[model samples]
Target: MRRAAWGFLTPFLALFALFFVLPLGYALVRSLYAVRRPGLGFGPASVEFAALRNYAAVLADPVFRSALGRIAVLGLVQIPVMLGLAAVLALLLDAGLARAVRWFRLGFFLPYGVPGVIAVLLWANLYVPQVFPLAWTDLLAPPYVLAAIGNIVTWEYVGYNTLILVTALQAVPRSLIEAAAADGAGPWRTAWSVKLPLLRPALVLTATFSIIGTLQLFSEPAVLRTITPAVSAGYTPNLHVYNTIFTDDLPHLGAAQAVLLAAVTFALSIAFLRVTRRWSAA
Candidate 1:
């Protein structure tokens, strides 16, 4: 039976190894090397093992540090706000608000169906003073661009998260809800005492996704970069890596930064899962 199971999984395992493991291994190997040019850039460039020099340089970079700080703040503010909105919407839908659950769900989820680049472009117009008469130009400024990007992310994913929560709510045993009602729990009390707790796993899932998405934020800012000076080539870590590869002509350095970012993201995800596990256990 175990051999049969392995046979059944072989194709997927092979594909995973080919697509995910192989590329990751290649990137890791590339990140340890630096391209060295001869004096006056006259000879063939050679790849030299850089050890941790590339990583050290990336960490010491002020732009990269600022990008990290910016995303951290964005995640802190955006994740809660997005999840809160999603939870409320899910609760309302589950409660059969106005008896139009299907329509409401579709309406809420419509933004997520829109292509991310198009959504960013649409929002960029609203932020760019030259394009819209009522534009909030201040929000497009350097100091507030992070928040603006957060708002865009929240808008895009809130509905998707709402759907996840709603599905979780749907899976709650009907008898538990009936018992709550029999014990004199009103809608609000039932939702507070029963439904919310049941939805914890869904909440954690959405939060984890939001954390990963926030760290990997790229498209929205990339789209906005052309329209506003607020977003520079190195506005985000992903953007920094992109600029290093394309604009600065340092693919090895860019690969190192990309690897470092992935490492940080992995560490954060592990920490979050550990905390959530403890919380759930308690």
Candidate 2:
């Protein structure tokens, strides 16, 4: 039986090792080395094992630190707002808005189907004063650009999270809802007492996804850079990594920063899951 199970998993294991493990190992190895150019940049570049120097440089960079702080603020604000809207929409659908449910669901999810870059371009037009004349170009300025990006992200993913919550709501036992109704419970009471509790797992799932997505914010700001001076090349951690590798030609430093970002993301996700689990238990 064990042999049969191994046979069934062998192909998947091989692909996982080939794709995930190999690339990660390469990045880790590359991140430990730094490029050295001798004699006023006239000599051949050499690779030197630099230990934690790349990580130290990435941590010391003001641009990278500012970008990290920006996204941290964005996730704190945007995740709650996005998830709240999604929960409301899901509850509305589950509340038996039968006739319009299909149309509403499709409309809400349509943005998710649009390619992210295209969506950013479409939104940029609305934000650019010359294009839309809404006089909202101020929203794309320094103090508000993070919020603008947050708005774009919320619009794109709210529907996706709604669908996830709605699926969880549907899996809820109808008998439980009927019993609540028999007890003279109102819709709000039933949702608060029955549905919301049942929706906890789905909420955690969506929240985790939102956290990861917010941390990896790249496309919208990258696209918006062309239209606004507010967005720097290092507008997000992912953007900073991209700029380091391509724009600055510091692949080792970029790799180190990327690895550190991944570590932070992983730690946060685990912490969130632990907190949610404890809350659910309580």
Candidate 3:
């Protein structure tokens, strides 16, 4: 049995190292090296190990710092709203309070099936005045653009989170629920007092996933960038890194920024998990 299990895992472990680990290691090594032109732009540029030069450059850039701050604000506002809506929908479905439960569930989850870029393109058209002509307001305006992107993200992932919560709800022991009922707990009280407590783990999962996704925000704003001037090349950290390497021809700086972004994501996720776990245990 052990031999068979190792054999089964070997293929997955090899692929994981090849596709994920190797590239990550390469990026880390490359980030420590930089491309430099020597002596009045008269010689061939060369890549040389510059230690923390790339990292320092990335850190000192105000544009990159602003990009990080932008996504921070977006996540703070969007994550809670999205997860709350998902929790409500999951609770409604679980309680059998809504009509056409199967259809409603499918409808809720359908947006997540749409490709991210495609969703952005669709929303871009809707936001464009010439395309859809909403005379009342402009979602693509500078002040509203971040919120607009947040709405797209919320639409795409709310269903996914809803399914997570719904699955968690299903695993809840019916005997516990019946006991709550016997204790004179109403449906609302039972859900608030019982089901919500049981969902802490799932909530933490969604929160961490959402946090990572928020930090790596790219698609929605990137697609909308073509339609709106509000989104700059440095609108989000991932997008900023993309523009840095491709647009500015600074792959070393991009690699450094990418590494830093990954590190930040990892640290934030770990910190959040520790705090949530402590709270849950309490």
The candidate that wins on lDDT is 3
Q: Write the per-residue lDDT of candidate 2 for residues 177-220, one digit (tens) a residue.
A: 99999999999999999999899889999999888888888889
* Candidate 1 wrong stretches, greater than 4 Å: 1-4, 129-137
TM-scores of all candidate predictions against the true structure: 0.94, 0.94, 0.94
Per-model root-mean-square deviation over C-alphas: 1.7, 1.9, 1.8
| Candidate 3, residue 171: lDDT | 100
What's model 1's overall lDDT?
Answer: 0.89
Ranking the candidates on lDDT from highest down gives: 3, 2, 1
Candidate 3 lDDT, 1-282, residue by residue in tens:
999999999999999999978987888999999988888867799999999999999999999999999999999999999999999999999988999988988999999999999999888777766778672468889988998899999999999999999999999999989999999999999899999999989999999999999999998888888888999999999999999999999898899999999999999999999999899788
Put down candidate 1 lDDT per residue, 159-231, tens digits, no spaces. Answer: 9999999999999999999999999999999999999999999999889888988899999989889878989
Deviation in Å, model 3, residue 39 alpha carbon: 2.6
Pairs that collide in candidate 3 are none
Angstrom error at residue 98, model 1: 3.2
